[model samples]
Structure formats: C-alpha cells, structure tokens
Target: MQKGGPPPGRSSTTRRASPRCSAGTSRLRRVCQLRGLASAVGSCSSPASKRPCRGRPESLACRRHGRSSVDGRHRGCMEPPATVGHVLALYPLDRPRAVGAFDASTRNDNLRVVDAGGRQFVLRRYRRNRDPERVRFQVRFQRHLEAYRFPSASAVEARTADPVVVDEEGFPWTLFEFVDGEHFDFSRPEQAREAGRRLAEFHDVADRFVGAATASLLEDDVRRFVATPRAVVDELRDAFGIPSLELELQNFRRRLETIAASLHPERLDALPAGWLHNDYHGRNMLFRDDAMVALLDFDKLERGPRASDIVRGVLSFARERRGSRVLRPVFARGFLAGYRERRGISAEELAAMPALAELAFAPYAAICRMLQADHQDPVAHILGDLQGMRETEAQCAALRQILV
Candidate 1:
C-alpha cells in the first residue's frame, strides 16, 4: 500500500515487440500485413457483402482475391481474431461458461468464469509489461503455498513457463482455480473473529518459509517511496488542492523514517525469511459456510517481514468502520490465538503494532489517492471512505480508552 515508485524491472507500459514472421509464410503474418484475402475484399466490398464473410475462408478470399488454391484451413489460423473472451470460451475445462467480466484495481485483467460443470474460476491476465522479477517471485510463491498446503487457490495454467500467457495482442494471462466463498463483512463481530483467526494461521505458517534468499517486499516499497515522497506529495497537492493532506503525508514519511531507523539491525538479520503474501486483505480472502476457506491473489508475494503479512490483515479489516464498532480487540484476540497456537507473538512484537499498522496503511492511502486522481467518480469513493474511516477512528478511540 506504500506510495512506492513504479514496480521494479520495466515499467508496465513497455511492450515487447512481436517476433517477425517471414512475409507470406504464415496466415497470421498475412493478416498482420493486411495482405490476406480478407483485406483485399474489405477494401472494395460493400457492407452488405460483409455479411457472408464471417469465417476464415471468406476472410482469406477477401485478402488473397486471386489465389484460389490458398487453403484457409491451417492450424492456429481461424477466420476471426481470437480475443480474451474467445480464448476463455475455448477453455477446455469442464466449468460453466463465463457470463460476465469484472475489473479490479490492479494491472491484471480479471474475468469471472462459470464452467460447463457449474464450477467457477477467475481468469487473470497480467499486464505484458510487468516486472520479470516480480512475476518470477509470484510464481515461486504459488509453488511454495502449494507445497505448504496453504488454503489458497491453485494456479490452473499459465500462458508461458514464466507464469504469463501472452495473447496474440501481447497481453499476459493466467488462470486460477476459483475459490467459491464470500469476502468477510467486517460489520459482524463473528466475521471479524474468524478473519483474525485465519490471518494468524496464515502468518504463522508463512513465517516459517521466510528465508534469507527471498527479496523483501516491504523494504522494496518503503525504499522506493521514501526516496521520492516529495514528488508524490507534490502531485497529490496539485490534484487534491489539500495542503493539510500534503502535510499529513510529510508527517507520515517522517514517521516511516523513524520506524526504519528504530528497526534493529540484529532483529531484521535474525528474523526468519520466506514467501509472504504481500497483499493479504479481506478482499483477497474467500469464505464458505462461515469459515475462511481460500486466499487468492499471490501476485504481490515476496520476501519480507513475516509480521508484514499479518499487518496487512490488521490494517485492511480493522482500519475503518461506518456504523459498526471497532472490532480490533476481537480480531486481535482471535488472530493471536490462532497465531500463538502455532508461533506465539512476544510482548515486544505487540508493542510494535501501532507503527506497523501505520506503515501498512500509508501506502494504501497513497494508492487510493493516485487512483482517485486518475479515474472518474474517484472523489465520491474517496469521500465515502473518508467518512467511514472517521467513524472507525471514533470507535477505535473509545475502545482504546476502555482497554487502557
């Protein structure tokens, strides 16, 4: 959630050039060059004549008007261009047909699918211009979770060995086994309790796998953002015209510096390292029959503070309340109970919660601001969230006063 600079490796806008095919060798090449049968007729054909040209044979005839012997029936050469929707329709899996598609805030394109067998799955396509290192880390993390028997959706198939499937148009695609469950509604206390318990279990198990070899997601984001908070702040100021928000961001950056400085070199050095599900949050989780069942979205997985994963759940679910109460204590208890059942949290660790919580929220706040600045109706969303968070702040203050 931190206001990091662009992700590592190449910017998401960069596109890899398609491999050049020899002239007139492949049908696709002919299609690209507009020299195929379809192009020729497309130029002179009336709109009414286009009605008969729906298939590949008609298209070939349109482009290569004089070549009667050119067979349109080649492997991988279909009449119409294959789109993501078309490819998904062709998914050989026995699931129900996809009825609709939804968009997420991330760079990935996600589609909801119901297979022929009435089962559901999510088809995610990563941006083709993603960081190779991040992509590798995500795939590795999936493998790790599979090995550890984590309650996460398994990867169905990737377009490439590298965990990305580049479409003919160069978009990267991947599919995940659909986790059938609802995301927890924080309005209910019981749900909060369950979320805590599941999150703790995730952290305890995830912590054991952390090793020195993996890259730290936290350090990466923090370093990137801290390096240029001023630029981000300036941009926000120009967009929002809120000087106070800019000051708050400056204060947030200073606090981050303080936390960074206070982090013990020895503790970090001694801390266990392994794959952390960097985007662990309520929305990324699925529940069935009143129990947490599956975790999804491992794209942000990386090596970092074991506690960082736990903190994501805390900040995400515990941060905002509209008409509801602050459920942190119940959540904290449930989470710690589950976590302690595997690996207990120490008093020192508990003391660090406030700082960690802030760190987790800062980047998220920045991301929300960024999105609002770029998109339509983002202001309404931001204002609504602010109102909710204000309510949550009052509830939290009251609860804290009582607890103290």
Candidate 2:
C-alpha cells in the first residue's frame, strides 16, 4: 500500500546466466570467442569448442554440428516466421491482422500490437507462474458479458484452448482485442456525466451476472496491509508529515472491516456468482467523441459485491477534478434512471452509497501511490488532480446535497 520499490526481499533485476565450456581443441577455443552469448552478437557461442583463438571468428559454427555452418548457424533449425496465425493459434482471435506494434512495460511479458483489422492484441510467450484458473475466469467473464449484450470486449480467440498457455521457455502469453477509444478525461464535465451513466448501465445489468463468491477486488490489498496498518500509516506519515494520518488510517481500517463484515452472506450466497470487472476506472472506459464506446482491461475481473462496480465508478469520478462535481450526480441520476428502468435499487442499497464512496477512497489512494512507486515517479499528476478535488469541496458538497 505504501509508495516504494518492490516489497523488500524482491530483486528488480533479472538473473545472470552462467556458462559451461566443452572439452576443447584450439579451433573451438577461438570459436568460443565467437560464442559471444553475453555480448551483442544476437547469437550464443557454440557450447562446444575445438580450439582457442583470439579475434572473433567470421564463420560461427553451430554447437550441434561439429564443423560446417550455414546461414550463421544451421538451415535445419531456422527460426519460425512471425505471423498472425501463429498469434491467433496461441491466443485465439476471431479475425486478426498485424497493424502496428508497440511496447508493453517490462512488468508484463508480451509484445503488444494494434492489429491492422483495427483491434489491439498482445502476443505473449508462455510463462509458468500464471494461474490458469484465473485466466479462465477472466475469459469466461468476457464471454458472460458478450452473452448478456453488455458493452465489453470479447475474447474471441486464444492460442491455447486451455486458458493458460505456457511457451517453450515457460513464459505465458495471451492476446486481447483492443477496445478503441480515448480514456474519459475528468476535465470534461459532459464526458464525466456520460461515463457515469455508462457505468451505471454496466452495473445495473452486471448485477444479474454470476460473480465469484470468494473474490473481492480489494482482497489482495486488504491481505497485504491487514496485519500491518501501522506500516502503511507510517509510510503516509513520512510522506504527508501529518499527525492525524495514523488515526485516519486506523479509522479507515475499522470502516473497511465493518463494510467487509456487513456484507450479507446469505444474499451473497444466493446471488448469481461469476465475474466482475474489478478495474473499472476512467482509463478503462473508452470513448469516441462524446459517447462512451467500450470498457477495456478485464485483467481484474473477479467476484465480489455488485455494488463495488458502481462504487468504483463513482470513486473514479470523485478522483477527477472537474468531473468529480458534475459527473457523479449526472451519473447517479442516469444510472438510477437506467437501473430503475430495468431493476430497481433497494432503499437499503441506495443508502449504502455514501459509505461505499468513503470506503472506496482508501484503496484507491493506496493504488495510485503504489502505481506511482512502481513507475518510480512522483505522482504529481494524480496528486495535483486530487488537490483539485480538495479545492472543489464546496461543489462536491453541493452535488451531495442535490443527490441526497
């Protein structure tokens, strides 16, 4: 929850490779110089060596073959071609074309590409440490949305029919279609209003979908800090130099625990259980011109309170400077309007909004700080905007009055 490097004991750097040399003659020794695996030769030195030499050799021999080499290594072991079908086979796509490629952060292992057919997809090599059940849950969530006609992207294809794909090197990979549209900008009042409305619509329908019973979007965060609230409080104390932060964190923790406890077990047990898109922030909501086109990023879909989705949307609105004021009411009105037109909100559920809003903020703030730390940059952008939120207290107060 605190802003800093990887949790203490973790190393950020990758492991270094060790080398073993074969019993040699002088030719292979000189050939070893050509091995140059550690260097930038784009090829590893033949693991086998015959003799020793000084300068790099032009004719790089293959480790497998004793002497002659063709095309730098061997014609028999030519590299495979990179093609859309290959990507589709690994991660199924309904239809695909390679449009352009871009880089994903080092944190993820995948090659990102905006397909020519106007879809964004990622080509990932397989990795072992991934959870297959989680991947299946995510894919199933997408399918559930599609089945319900919800405004979300569909996972049309995957390389491995199995939800998890482990590549030759034990790396994992999957492709997702890009949901095209700009992220909703909080600076725009109209956009914020629309985002709110769309989110409300999403939540209203999403209520009927099954979500995982044990899953809570905040589970990871809660577990991480449950036993160490003081550590987080101390981190905030260092950052903000505020005497009240410790108490504030303790109070926040109590509120979270109460909310977690108050969740109706019987109601939750009876409700449909499936998937919920856990990350439903502004960036995940795509827009075209003035209208919200699609919501992307299903990486966080899990099981929990349906209200959590609406709460997340509202919190995202609250975090936006200009949008915080106008969007929430507009979204509330629109969402309630839409939900009522379909299924109605209970009085109890309606009354829970304010508390939900309060409960949502702490996790949200912690996430922003964690992201800033992970990126190794000051969260000037987020902090400045949040400061703007503080400045708009009067406006928010007025909106709350109007909504209540």
Candidate 3:
C-alpha cells in the first residue's frame, strides 16, 4: 500500500521525457518508446493485426486527452508509463498525478497516494488469467466483504461502472482505494495476533459466499503434479540444459511422493470447506501501529479446507529461525488460539496440518519447473523449500504437540 517508488531493480527516481503535444497517430507510439518497449504500438494500431510488444496490448498507452471526462487528462511527468497512468485515470480523479510501481510479486501495480484533487488509489494490472469467471467471482467476493465493513482493500469500479477493464492487448486491470497503514511486521507477536484475529473474521464472513470461481483443491493439486513420472523431470532437465540438477530433482520427487503417499486425500477433501483468502501472509496484510488495518490480495481466494489456509498462513507468517523451516511455536499458538476464538479446528484438521503443509511443495516445485519455460531461475525458491520438506518430519512431531 506504500506509494511513489519504483519496484526493486528499477530506478527509484524518475524524470519525465519531453511531452508530446502532436495530434498525429505516429506520435501515439512515443509513450511506448518512452517506456523503452521498442515494439510497442499505439491506439491507432491493432494488436490482433500485428504481434504485440512482448505480447502486451498497445492500448496500454495513455491518451494525452482522454476519450471521456471521467477518464481524466493525463498531465505531467510520472515515473511509470502512459498505460499505467491512463489506467489510474480510469477511476475518477483530478489531474497533476505522480505514479510508480509498488512492492508486488505476482502482478503489475501502480500506487498513487494523491491525485490532483488529493484522492488516493492503487491501480493494479492483474496477471493475465484465461478465466473471466474467476475474476468476476473475486470481484463479487471482495464487494461482499466490503459491505460487511471488513478491514480489507476492495476493488473500485472503473469510470464505466465495470469492476474490471480489459486493456487493448486483453489483460484485466482494476483500481483500489488506497489503504493507509504499514504492512504487517512478522517479528512482532502482537501484530501476528492481530493478523490471526482478522483472518478468523475473514473466514467467518467468507463462509456465506456463493460464486462460480473454480479452483483446484490443494490435495488434488499435489496429486496432479506429484504423479509426474521421474522421466519427466529428467526430460525437463535435459531440455533446459540443466542435466546436473536431475539427481537432486529426482531425490526431491521421491521424498515428495513418499510424503504424498501418507496423506488422506479423501479425508482432506471431506474436512469442512469454506472460502479462503488462499494467500494470507504478513505482506498481504496491512497494519497501523501494531494493529492490522487491512488484508490485501484476494486474487487467489478459493473454497478449501479452513485448516489448509491456517497452515499456509503459518508457513508464510511464522518465523523459521536457525535455517530450520519449522513453524515457530509462539506464532502457531497465537494464530491457532485466535482462530479457535471464532470456530473450532477439529482433531482431524489439526492432525493433517503437518503432512498437508509438507505435501504443498509438490505443486510449488512443479510450477517453478514450469517457469523455466520463461528462462527464470527457480532454484533460489525451490532449493530451500525442497530442503525444508526433507527436514520437516522431526519438526512435525514437535509442531503437533504445540498445535493440538
């Protein structure tokens, strides 16, 4: 929710290039070139007729004079591109704006603290997903929580009253009212307790939601990828020219399969199900002076076992000191205690937590392998996770005592 800074690895400071006041169509591509995408096209061009720059839509370029009053005029030099500035303008705002990316891992984000009229908002370009139904359900669910006054960021409709808008290259983007608070600090127990309390409130409100947003069940997800034959890893390793990694990946696969074999897939599925934020961690939560102010990022919201969400939170938010990846007892105690304050986590749910948490690596590591198609190094994230899964057995026994 912080504003006015470029994302990591980007220049923190920005100065606008010379303004383009030309009325011609050729001048339209100037915004794209300014952003450093040479292949980027302008509004006069059709993305479908030609290949888009880096597969992104040319419609992302902002119009110096918008099509409507509500769209607002984009004036002044801002750190971000014209497309982002235009998207931020989609919501009703005054002119004289400043924009930049925020600290987000999975999506494109522009955080604007104050518009010309001093209005604050966050414009987010969601990761391009093929599922429109899922996007709709997420929008509705956030509205549902906002109606109840839950402390969370809700999507604001665009100028056309549509909750979501498609860019020219066909990507979904939305605007959010700026949440004023510091992000949750994991080192603080009180902050963690507040996070736990808010999470319980979220689950309670989410239980009543009925929508068509489809999601893969966690256990089923593990089954799907863990079932991949050992040869698949070998093939991927050779294809990617990382043949040396085959032995390590093979060992991880064997360990993952063993952990997968011990899980009660049917029982995990049968355990009480409800709407989950799917991703509940410190970074996704906002806080003010130690109290949680808002929970952000509901894109992964889904129907799943409540316990799965709890363990995911623990894994994400809890401390892992001394390089041991084990859940901190203190954090676990507070979170479980807070969750129980609203609804009870049954014995079955508690018992399955450790194994379920361990088996999570199967799908996660597989996705990292998938990311290699884009030439990203998945080693940094995967190495620690695979090692943690290998070492979790001893820690699981200790964690069970504290959990139950």
Candidate 4:
C-alpha cells in the first residue's frame, strides 16, 4: 500500500455527501460561517470551530463507517478484526462495547472505541507503511506533553515495554485517551487567546524535551509549496470541473512563488527552530466554550521554524472564520497577548511570519488529499479542499503591520 493511501486493490466507491455541506455545488466552496454552527471541513467541527474547504461530493470531515454508511455496514475502513484484543492487551480499558470508524482521516485510520464502561477512546490504527520507530517517538513525545499537563490527546501506554501494540497483522496501533470537545472556535477572542497561550506553553515544554526528533516536514516542500500549484493549475481545473478556478489559483500561485523566493530556505533557517506541532490548526484541535480542551493529531511532529507554525495557526483561524482570509486585528492581538504571557515572538520573528506564512499555509495550495489517501470516488471528494487564501496573500503588508 502506498503511504497516505488505500490498498491498491480495493476499488473506491462513492459515498453519500453530508447534508451540512451538500447545500449546493456553489455552496460547497462557501466557508462555514464562523458564528454559526456549521463547519468548513465537512461536519467534523464544533460551534466554536470552523474549517476552510473548497468543494466536494462529500464533506472532508465525515463519519467514515457506521449505520451512517451507505448500507448501514462497516465498509471501506481499516479497523482490525481483533480491535477488542488490541485494546485489552495494550491499555487499561474495559472490554469494548463497540468500535467504529471515527473521522475521515487518510493517513493513520482513527477508530472511536467505546468500552463496556461507556467511556470513549481513539485507536490510531497504523497503515501498512507505518514505521514503528516514528510512531514510538511520537507516542513518547505525547507522554512528555502529558507530564507537563499540556492539553494533548494523552497516549495510553501498553502493558509491555513498547509504547505501541502490534496487531496480529503486524501493523502497530496507539490508543489515545478520547477527547470529546468542539473544534476550535475562531469567532471567540478568548478562545483564540487561549489557543495562543496553549501553543506558547507547548513550545516552552518542547524546548526541554530530549529526543531524536524527525526531520522538518517542510525541508523539501518549500519549493513545491510555491511552484506545484501553478504547474498543476490547468490539470486540476479540468479534473475538478471548476471552470473559473484556474485563474484564481494561477494568481495565488504566482504570488506564493514571489514570497517564497524572497524567503528562501537559508533565510528561513536563520530563524529559531523548535519542536513544532507541524499540523497545528483548528481542524486538529478540540474546544469547549472558550477553552481549548485538547490538541490532537501529532503525526506531523517535527523540528522547524517556530514562527512558521505560529503564523499558520493565526492565519488558519482567520481563514476559517467566515472565509475572511484577511487577518483580523482582534484575532492577532488576542492570540499574541495569550502567547506572550508564556513565550514571546520577537519583533524579528513576527516580521518574518508574513512570508513564512505564504510558504506554510496549506489551504492556499489547494490540497486534494482524497486523490492520494482517501478511498472515496475521485469526483466525490477530489475537490474537497481547493479553498484558496489569495486575499491573505494580498494583505500581507497589513498583516505584517498588525503582527509588528
């Protein structure tokens, strides 16, 4: 099986679209209203949370399998047959009452497990190409965060010496204490500030962390981040049947290239490096009211420019809040105030963020992950994440002024 993809032999089938996102094809590109209770990443969001997306046959955030399945069956999922044993053997949990596919993640398949005690947990069933070392390192890192009382999805340790449990098929699995909360709410200033404080605390704790960390995910992708979109513009436009999207994407790509060239890899390397939550954003967070309860999805944990992650987080909040991609003064101030209470982003670091943001932001690149990992039909979810942030790029100077 290819990394971040389904097994080659299993043909993909069309799944029903979530009604929350199927308002219309045109509405598919419309970002969920920040104040409203809809989500930008399909239906996997909270009243406080919003996500950015393009258009697709189905929602990006979806329940993968359950009675909600096409025919009330567990189809197209990777839940091991002996999931109960995996949990019972590895962690301290009662016998599972039921196990079901949780979210529509493409990489590590997430299964929501309910124990006989009615408590919940998420079992991260590793893919065939999954590395035990990498997962072990991530699991250990998770434990370190727990030691500091950081708001991470706590990893449940195995009874054995290893952090991970090996299934009968030899694939490794890590069980995480279930975190049930709404997605990050960008509309609330307190939540934004709270998120910033949490992130700052994360960096503070990570600095004391001692481990052989993974390579930066952005090491080779900086150039691709700028150039790939322009090169694939026409092909993607045709594939998704988005008529006028080519011009918009082309414009954004051109701007991204310019920004990336100004801030080359060497230039970015000049900034400080740290253990980054490489995928830190609203989509990977859980919240309750104004408090960020848990930070989820550490799969992309690695060392990288600290400013890049910080900029990406604020910009993502801006993007998801009613699709207004421009940075709002309130969000910037609130987040930074909270972050500053713990650790500070230097004036120089703040200055570098606008350009780094152009390189780090994912939505700007039109990520179509369904083409790679998801087993959904090509047309069904192929265009699920083509949402662009041309407005954010255009207003970088304004954003920089706000950051400063």
Best by TM-score: 3
Give the C-alpha miss distance for residue 214 in model 4, angstroms. 3.6
Report the C-alpha displacement of residue 266, candidate 1, in angstroms.
6.6
Q: In terms of lDDT, which candidate is strongest?
A: 4
Model 3 has an lDDT value of: 0.58
**Comparing 1 and 4 on TM-score, the stronger one:** 4
TM-score, cand. 1: 0.59
- Candidate 1 stretches greater than 4 Å from native: 1-82, 89-91, 94-97, 102-107, 127-129, 158-163, 187-190, 207-220, 223-249, 257-274, 319-328, 364-404
TM-score of structure candidate 2:
0.53
TM-score of each: 0.59, 0.53, 0.74, 0.66
**Could you list the CA RMSD of all candidates, in the order they appear?**
13.1, 13.1, 8.3, 12.0
Residue pairs whose backbone atoms clash in candidate 3: 57-169, 60-83
lDDT by residue (1-404, candidate 3, tens digit) is 54333323422222222223222223333433444322223222222453212222323333322222211122211222445545656766665243334555343334443566777777666543324455666778888887888877777777888777766544567677888877656577777677777788898888777657665222234333344535444544554435566567777667656654655456667677887787787767778888777887776676667877887766665665423466777887887777777778888888878876775454353445444432345665456556667666556777778776
The candidate with the higher lDDT, 3 or 4, is 4
Q: Rank the candidates by TM-score, best first.
A: 3, 4, 1, 2
Question: If both were scored by lDDT, which would come out higher, candidate 2 or candidate 3?
Answer: 3
Q: Under the 3 Å rule for N, CA and C atoms, how many clashes does model 3 have?
A: 2
A best-first ranking of the candidates according to their lDDT comes to 4, 3, 1, 2
lDDT of 2: 0.44
Model 2 residue runs over 4 Å out of place are 1-111, 114-120, 123-129, 167-171, 187-194, 204-275, 318-341, 363-402
Error at 38, model 2, angstroms: 20
Instruction: Give, for candidate 1, the lowest lDDT window spanning 10 residues.
Output: 36-45
